[model samples]
Every structure is written in C-alpha cells, then in structure tokens.
Target: MKRSSFFSVSLAIAGAAALAVAVTAPASAATPSAATPDTSGVYSVHPIVEKAGLSTSAVTPSLTPAQCLAQTAGRVACQTPDSIRAAYDIPATINGVPAGTGQTVVIVDAFGSPTVQSDLAAFSGAFGLPTPNLTVYYPGGKPTWTGKKTQTGWAEETSLDVQWAHAVAPGANIALVVAANDRGATIDNAIKYAVDNKLGNVLSMSFGEADNLIKSPNANNGQTAQGVKALAQGAAQGMSLFASSGDSGSDNGAGFANYAFPASDLNVTSVGGTNLWAGSGLNQPRETVWGDFANCPLTCAFGVVGETGGAPSLFTSKQGSDVAYNASVYTGVLTYLGFLGGANNGLYFFGGTSAGSPQWAALTADTIQAVGHTVGNVGQQAQSWASKGLLYDVTVGSNTTPTFSGGYSATAGWDRPTGWGTPDVNGIIAALK
Candidate 1:
C-alpha cells in the first residue's frame, strides 16, 4: 500500500455487484506519500495509559490518515491482548480454561523476529492470559537475510501473528513454519513446507503478491491445481488454511486491488479487514463495526509499489475475507518501532487484517479446546448463519478516500471488505457446535 507521491488509474471497479459504491476522499487530501515504512516516527504514536481506569490514558491518539499507512503495509504487527479482547469480546480473565497444552495452531510467515519469545511473555503477562503451546520451525533462517529494514516489516508481522495467537489460546500448541522471504518461490515453498511437514488443522498465512496473468508456474501464481489437490488431501486430513487477503483490495493495491495466494485458493479461509471500536474499560455495552479503507490512485512522485502492483485476481470469488477484525490504523495496538536517526525510541501504531486473521485462528484454538472438537473445513461453517450470527457483524462506518475506486462501505448485509464481521468469543464458542 505504498503512498509516497502517487497516481492511480481511475478504475470503474465495475460489476463485482456484491460491493460497488460511490467513492469519496478528503477535500485537501494530497496524493499520499508512497505508503511505505515510517522511517519518520509520525505513525509511532500510542495510547496514553496509567495505573488507573480509562482516562486520557485509554484515549487513542491521532495521526493524519497518510501517516497511518505503514501500520497495515507489513503484516498486522502491533496486535496486543487488549485489542484482541475488544475485537473478540473474550472476557478479561481468559485464564478460565487450562492452557492449550494439547491443541495446535501453526503460523506460516516470512522470516523470523528476534524478540518473538520475550514479546510473547510481555503480552501474556500484562493481561493475565495463558501462555500457549509454542514452537518455531524455520529449518533455517536463510543464512542470507539478517532480517533488516524492508525484511523487518514481514518478519515482525510473522512474530506478532504466531505469538499473539499462542497467547490468546494458551492451551493450544502453536508452531511457526517460516519462509525465507516475502516474495518469489520462498512463500510458496513455505506453504508447501507447512503442508509437507503435516502441519495439519489450523494453519495461518499473513502476506503475499498478485499474478493477474492467467496462471503460470514461473509467474508467482497460486498453488497449481495439482498442488491445490494435494493440499486438499491435506485439508481432508482436517487441516484448515487461513491467509490474509493482502493489504490491497480487489484491484491488487495498484490502488484498489487485492492480492493472491492461499487467500485466493478456494480451499483456504481468506481473512479481511475491519474498523472496530472497543471500550477498553468502558464497561458499557460494547459495539463492534466493520472497517475498510479505500486506496488512492498512483501519482508520478510515488509510483505504484511493486508489492502493491500486479493485476486483479485471475481466480473468481472465494468465500473469504470469510471473516474480519480490527485492521485499521486508528483502532490498532501501539508498539515501539526501532528509533530512527538516534531519536526517541519511537513508539508506533500497527494493525491490518494481518492482526485479525491470527486472532481468528487463535480463537479457533480456544474454541477447539473449550468444546473439545477439531471441526476442520472451517470455511463452510464460518459463513453459515450459525457462525455469522455468532460473529459481531461489524455494521457501521465505511472507508472514503480519493485514491481508491473500489468503495469499502458497510451496508446492512455482508460486505466484500469484511466478510462475516469479527468473532464474538462467547458466541463463537457456542456457535462451534
């Protein structure tokens, strides 16, 4: 979703029938800077907290929408326990159940983060959540990558997804199957890697690119049908694949497009984005809503980003963004990105359906643990009325901006950007039956 000096072709985003709406943008919105990592700490802001009830402490800070782009660009990296609680309606004291000692959830992503283990500890400790079954599987960390800068975006995302899911569903065994890079054959290999190793039941993927040309093995397309067939055999063994629909929408981030991969695969669950409003300690009836943003067209100053380029999906619709959670920059968790220019140890905000997908995966673990069942092929049940109603059905608000042609507005019924809304922990557990 790069934004530095940009321009985008005005796509009519015709006849998706299910989701076309009029587009809008701020009056004075400048063509956003190519949306990239915030080397400047403008987006490095956090909620002001204290040893007290909700105050200015819980008050979410503000940054221009342009400054917020980096948060979702990588992977939804700042997913903290509190965000999960509001987004899921899981009780404050999730220690009610035993740690997920036997169940399993495997996270597949690019690269690895150095502080994954310690960060897990801090997140779990702060909220009194259970410590989940956790392990890492990289086979090798790619002796080539040191995991610096651009690599950091995807690497940190991988760490946050694996750890947060494990923390929320502590009793579940969590394994991380790592890939060497964010592009090329590496990601495909990572997915196959997880499948080959028999990492069955509940798998998660948080990134990818698009291949608009009719499928070609060398063109970075999805698993070949034969490959998909083999994966289906794995799914028959009760394995479920979950992937982020990508930061870009249906147009493939060339402004308003969506990317491919496991997300595009019919056999997998495609998680989407949402803007959620949670009352940290408000204690009133909390309300949940859908969140999706529109992208701006490309401009010469900031060219269409490679990751954000490529054509629309060749594959037709699948059931995903089968579900969603808070992936917007404003309602996201806050953390500290490494300080730049030896300035303040910069604090920042981050979230994307990247954060939400793993959150859903972890909730599945908790439900599996609670009900003691491993109902695979969750994609079907996920869209059922039982599951849909169990979810929060985030129904308010919509993304309005000039850059994007495809509108991500929330209508009365289901929307493209966020499928069946987010999960309602208690209701989701009940719906599992």
Candidate 2:
C-alpha cells in the first residue's frame, strides 16, 4: 500500500488492538506550503489528491520530469533512476560484473499487480535501463481481483517494488512472490515458499503491521513466529532480509510509541525513511529523518503525507529501523504504472519506506556480486560501518508527531529513527566483510 493508505490502516489496526490514540486539531493550524527551490535545492511538484467523488479511471497522460515540476506548485522533490544512482555514487559495475548480474532479489507483496511486467518494461525503457530478468510466483495461486481499492493500492505497491528494485540494480534477477491475501498467515506462507525454494539471496518486505497489535492476545496469529522461523532459515542460508519499519512516524499512528512487526523482529534489517536531496551543480546530496510533524493540517490529520517509523520496539530491545532511505512524499521518486486503467498508465511520483526496502535489497544484490557471495543480516554490518564512519549519517529531523510525544529523534550516532543512517552504497560495498 502507499504510505497514505498505510497510515489509515495502521491507525485502524491500532484501534482494533485498543491502542488507538485520540487526535485533536489545534485551533489555528498551518497549511503545508509548496516546495521552494531555494531552500530545498530541487524542483518541486505536489500530488494531485483524489477528491471524494473523482474517478481514478480518467486518462492521465505521462509527463516529463520538467513537466512534472512545471505542472504543480506543491512542495515535493522528484527523482529519476539516473539521479538516484548518481546521488548514491553507485557504480554501474561492481568488480568485473555489472552490479547485480548474477544475484536475485525476491519481493513479497499481496495481490500483485496485473500489469507489473509491462510497467517494468516501460519504466526501464523510459530511464534507459536494461530489461530485468523478472519472474512472478503465486504461493496460493493467482488471486482473483475484486477491484477493491485495497487491491489497487497493492498493485501500485507491486509496481513500485518491481520497478525500483530493478532501477537500482538493473542486472539482478527479480523474483516477485505474490501472496493470496494480506492476512498474516497467508503472507507468511508466501515467505515460507520463497525460503523453501531458495528464490533469492536478498529479500524485501515493504509492508508491516503494528507490533503491539501483532502481539495482542486477540490479534496474535502465530504469523510472526512463522515469519521469524522462515526468515531465520533464509539467514542461516546467507540471505539478506529487509522490511520497511512503517510509514507513520515513531508512534506508528497509535497515539503512543510502538513499532511495526516483522521489522521489529531482530532477524530482519529494518529499513527506515529519509528526505533526500540529490545534489546538482554545487549542492551536495543531503538527507534528514523523514517526518511531516510540523506540517500537520493536511499532512497529519489526513495522513496523506509521509513519515518514517523509528522507535524501540515494544516487543524487543532492538530498534525499529536499522537504516534509512529517501521516503518523503514531498521528496518522492518517479514510478511507472499501467495497472491504474484508462490513461492513468504513466509515470507518477511515489514515496514511503516501501521505496526504500527494495532499493536496499537491490544494494544487497550488488554487495553479493562485489563480495563473491551472499552476506546475511546487514544490520550488524551496517552498525560496524557506522562505527567506522562509512555510512551517510543523518543527524537532523525527528519522527515525533503531535499525538505521539515520545517519538524518537535523529542523532549523531545510532538512534531509533534512522539507526546507523542512510547508506553510502559504494562505501558500504568497499567496507563489507
């Protein structure tokens, strides 16, 4: 799901678990402004919000990057695959191999996109990238579409995961395992299938549920236990695993501090969110912990904006996020999707830690190529890199929201929100054991 939808879903989960926090609007709220090039150093564009009665089937034509900027006065940064690669200093080839040439990345999602293959091809062609070695699998058989909004959201997510993972590591093979549904056990079953089949050396899960909710007596389904077992098996076999921490700031939309499950599990590397400024001319790339706390009126109340989840877990001593990546809707990356129907088959800007996880998994593919073998459990390696000043340290911004006062802050070293910080991919590749 996109971050906005996920926000409402997380809050709904919290409500079901009796962890929902009450939100009260302040008397005089400030509306968020459009992005300013002078301050942010990137051309900005805002999303066209779907109105109450608008149809999503309208034929929205694709726009150029320049057109994207000129079309809106909203405050948001737009990025391309080339710009992201340049920003991170990721090499086209690691060692003698073209980045992820021999590796594979497995993406787990529910209700996979109907048009992902074509969408991925279009995305690659638009960005001058090679066609990916892609395959899609369904553990519980292909899902019959009900045309539900949730299904559409998952389809968008599927496109984002498949496209961006390939964008980051164009040479890697991709294995997309579609779950029958979003149910805990069902999702776990897909994961178990991937592990049993040895689908890939790197895996990414771009979804998560609230930690407290997963552990609640009324909600625990043994799914977390089953997921952990499957992930542990993958780890033992040298697969690097990743999951998005969440998109609802540190409190995770619960009105109090909590963490997201799967990501909260110590076995997985929890990827967090950041606002990225890919440098141009004289400006250097910069990042900050992703949060829109101060932009509360439309951002917080509607939960349509983006925020990174980073806090100590209610279930474990481990932090919720181990590393961060660009995830601000205000600073989102471009994605191609044809599954929206009608003329909506075009490029759109998307953000969320969901964008981060697949890219991280792609980075792991390169890491595997560089090291001549798979490296499991990147969290420990990332910590070691941070200790050596090898990663990009994000020391600004906070994940606190108006309702959740106990939210975590970004700090000099390892902190809850961004953990060791964003990856300097090349530096990490060089520093890998």
Top candidate when judged by lDDT against the true structure = 2
Clashing pairs in 2: 34-75, 35-75, 59-343
Per-model TM against the reference: 0.69, 0.82
Off by over 4 Å in 2: 1-74, 95-97, 216-220, 280-285, 295-304
Overlapping backbone residue pairs in candidate 2 total 3
lDDT of 2 by residue, 189-267 (tens): 8999999999999999988776645553123446667877898898888888998877777775567777776788777
Tens digit of lDDT per residue, candidate 1, span 198-295?
Answer: 76467776654343422643344344443455457667777766766655444443344434555666677677665443533323223333223343
The weakest ten consecutive residues by lDDT in model 1 span 43-52
Q: Which stretches of candidate 1 lie over 4 Å from their true place?
A: 1-83, 91-96, 140-145, 211-231, 255-259, 280-313, 334-348, 386-388, 399-404
- The per-prediction tally of clashing pairs is 43, 3
Candidate whose TM-score is highest: 2
